[model samples]
Target: MRESKALQVLKGRHLRLEEPLLLSTVSGVASTKPALIRYFDQKISPIGIITTKSFQVTPNPGNREPVICETTKGNFGNSVGLRNPGMDQALAELRALRQEWKFRCLLNVSLSANSVEDFIMLVEVFSEVADILELNFSCPHAAEGYGASIGCSSEISSDYVRKIKEATKKSEVPLFVKLTPNVEDIGQVAKAVVDAGADGLVAINTVGPIVHEDPVSHTPILQNTIGGKGGCSGRWVHGKAVSCIKEIRMAVGDDVPLIGMGGVSTGEEAAEMVLCGADAVGIGSAFGTVSQKDWEPYLNSVLAEAEARLKPGKEYLGPKSETYLAEDRQMAYRKHTVTKIAYYGKDTIILTLDGSLPCKAGEFAFLWLPGIGEKPFSVAHNDPLTFVVKKRGPFTEALWLLSLGSDLYVRGIYGAQLENERTDKALLVAGGTGVAVLPALAQQLKEQGTEMTILVGTSESVAGKALLEDRLSGFGSFTCVADDGKNGRVLDLLNGLSLGPDQACYLVGPEIFMAIAAKKLILQGMEEEKIYLSMERMTLCGIGMCGECVCGDRLTCQWGSFMRYDYLKEHAPSMVGL
Candidate 1:
């Protein structure tokens, strides 16, 4: 399976290295930094190295406190307060990596300065030694006059990128501006950089100096009592990253190529980034998957697998499922029937299609709204595709505008199956639109006349209650809660609906609600796998092409739109956007 054109572009550009490969640095081992070099060398490829920070002649100590920690929220936060070994030492490290590596590395030299002269001087020093000079306009953790201090204010970031572009006038060395995701609208900042003559954009430099605590102590883990949360990484950060890439791609069009990074762990992850409009994939956490010895082999295997998965000629990333559909008439339209359609309000509608008899109980169908776009919606009914949608945005709006006889586009009978139906009576919990899939499962149980109970949580919206009433008419038993007292509170409903230990549970709603519910249930001694839930992330590529819809290592569009509560709890912190 050859790579789709979107992926080929990313893998095509070859960065030239200096010398033979060497594993001289283990300090950066946790990041698989060396394997990046080895990946380029063995693969005979050319990619850039985003070098660590370096200041001007004057040295500055970054945040001098606890930089990293694990939080109860299941995420890592660090206040690596701009700790650098000074310019001379930093230059030496870059020189060493340059001298021994096979492919020529594009040095994204990061530097912070208070004045124009300071930036000029640093660029002067790295001009000869470095490939691309990245002006550090977006480090959220820096002191006054540096990092986001300069980048956040468009005027400052623009002036700095312009100055550096002029200083490197003699050389065409591309100057990239590492933008901060902390901004209200990152696209506006990206536009500023482009106008300032930045060669390209390196979006989102982490969410913040997030903090993890000692579970027992229940106190802050890091010494830096205050942390500027940087870019959210791991699985949670995927959608945010994609959103940034999409905004930049939309704003810039094709004038400059994008180097997308953040939360990418596999080749498929890399492929997804490309489809959302990235030229190359910057992998950092992927190194965590393999050991030092297995780095080369791991990179090789993932690269091969990713290449095989992509389509032949699509500008976007992933396997290009839509593109494939365009080519083969036989593959274009799949057959499905609308089992049920419930209109909650003028804008909100729930449609349960039929055709999922071939799939497992919890599997989902990829709902494509033609020109509108695509998203992975869990099967509300399952015979076909039962979706509860509100006229929220473009896609959902388009769905609302759709009539019953209108043609609907859909793909993928994809997702994990409920391998063993829990003979243990089941408990189903839903929130808002989360109840879309509950009806189908309920219908199945009702037909079989099995023991099942459903609990739905919603806000004080009549539409929500209306939809719930329509869907739960035939279930074993049903309860509805409206936060505003119109119905009842979700918590109230749950408290009222009791079940014994021999019951499996499924939860689908807002993340916080599910988290709270799962945590409470676990304390009640329920098995982790007994509870399941739905998570909605940015699902750019339905076939798991774009890693946009990720929850830890799994693609919500592929492995799940439905996942075990235990799995989610384990990866929740890292799975931020859920």
Candidate 2:
């Protein structure tokens, strides 16, 4: 439509963005949870704009596990339920964010609501710190009355946008309406919102409230009200996004700001956004491409690539600062055959797959059963890839009953590696199914030449605890006790436990068990830093995109499955409370 120009000015009330070729996070993936936002602020460049997850007026628990997953086509579909820490906490977080970054990076606060009045109310409150108030009118899988309800209809969208914009005119905050492509006439919806007075347009939120199934089991993945259907994004929808942005540009006129995003992983793809008349690129699922440890350097390269490929008023923005080497790589799944299955009675079983997985102790992996679903399990044994599955629900039940030689889809080996620090000794405590996490750790300590002692607790029904006793005993020390065992349970073993000057204690099980165990160790004069505990959460995406595995500001999928006690006490204090 016109010559490319520098995208330096994002223009909310004022734009302090440092880069010309614009970059912003698409809400719901990267920036959410106040602590996560702070982590990104420290790592992400000042040029990068931070967008929050779509926060509602009240707190949202979001969807159940199997909330987000990958499609066979390498795309992602999520029904994350617009989870957020209600407005009250959000206000304090946004205030703290200001203190943390001090406006070094611009904040685009995203809001979602069912009504125009509620939207307007959110703008008023969030505008206090928001450089740009992003109105999320288009989350495909959110509960009814939320995102898609406002975005799918031009009449509904126009009326709402006009009202919200009218209310915010005095606040002078730029209202960028996020649009969905699920509508029949997306351009019409775009024109209506723009004519009503949106300061900017974020084209194409996700396409299709479609269903993703297990390839064999056909079990639906997303846990939303709509029968497991979700919106698809990533490389699969980039074409749709480009087309939507182009149509929006045509409908709104060349002067309006547009952020085109979907499957933007390369300089060429970023160039496609600009060519389609986008002022900025919205990066969504591509954030899943890099693990959290590599979040900073990886994103910097993507930013450099986009900046290098663009032009501002006929001046070629050349010399990309960095190369996106990992663009071609994705967190992938490998197929394995369930060669061995061991039953610990009806409730618990061990499933071992053929071949080994490359993983460190304390790291975990996700196991997928096509047509069934995917769930994360601690790597019980990396070599021969074993998992001790306890029948918790349908997911584990399927695993427990799986026939030998059946296939297993495995991905990850994700999370922080437990540092192999040689100490005077190592003490391991396991409870119920949590015993699956210890063998690999025991192996690590044994290899380090550190003395090892293991304590395990499980159901009384599993009478013959031979497997549990045998595996851990290989590491030098083993003690197993059940709920009704004569040994007075595993907790009894902790009483007057001998203390080593430089021993490390790794405990995994239920929260109460860990808390009480930690308290006992502390009472026994153990160092808090020397005590490590595995924090379990519903993990999806293996990476941090799903927001289900956050332990404080830390993404447990990356920062840890096992974090030291001192760190948890400060950041994840909820774990410390009995």
Specify the highest-TM-score model's number.
2
Worst 10 residues of 2 by lDDT: 1-10
How well does candidate 1 match the true structure in TM-score terms? 0.46
Worst 10 residues of 1 by lDDT: 20-29
RMSD of each: 17.2, 4.9
Candidate 2, lDDT over the whole model: 0.77
Q: In order, what lDDT does every prediction score? A: 0.56, 0.77
lDDT of 1 at 153: 78
lDDT of 1 by residue, 241-356 (tens): 87888888788766564677766555566656666766656654333222333444554444443454454542323333122111211112354545566776455677766555
Q: Give me the candidate number with maximum lDDT.
A: 2
Superposed on all Cα atoms, model 2 deviates from the true structure by an RMSD in Å of 4.9
lDDT for each residue of candidate 2 in 1-578, tens digit (9 for 90 to 100): 12111223543211212345667777887676676676666667623667888888999988766677776545888778788887888888788768755765567889999999889889999978887788899998888889998898899989998888877777766788999998887889988988998878887788888897755444676777788898888779989888887888788777777777877766668767877777777776866766666666666666656555554443335433234233332345678899988876568888889999866666888887755667888888778888888788777878876897888888777787787458969899988888888877887787888888888887775654576668888887787787764422788789999988989899998878898899999999999999989887767677777666877677888776888889889877887783
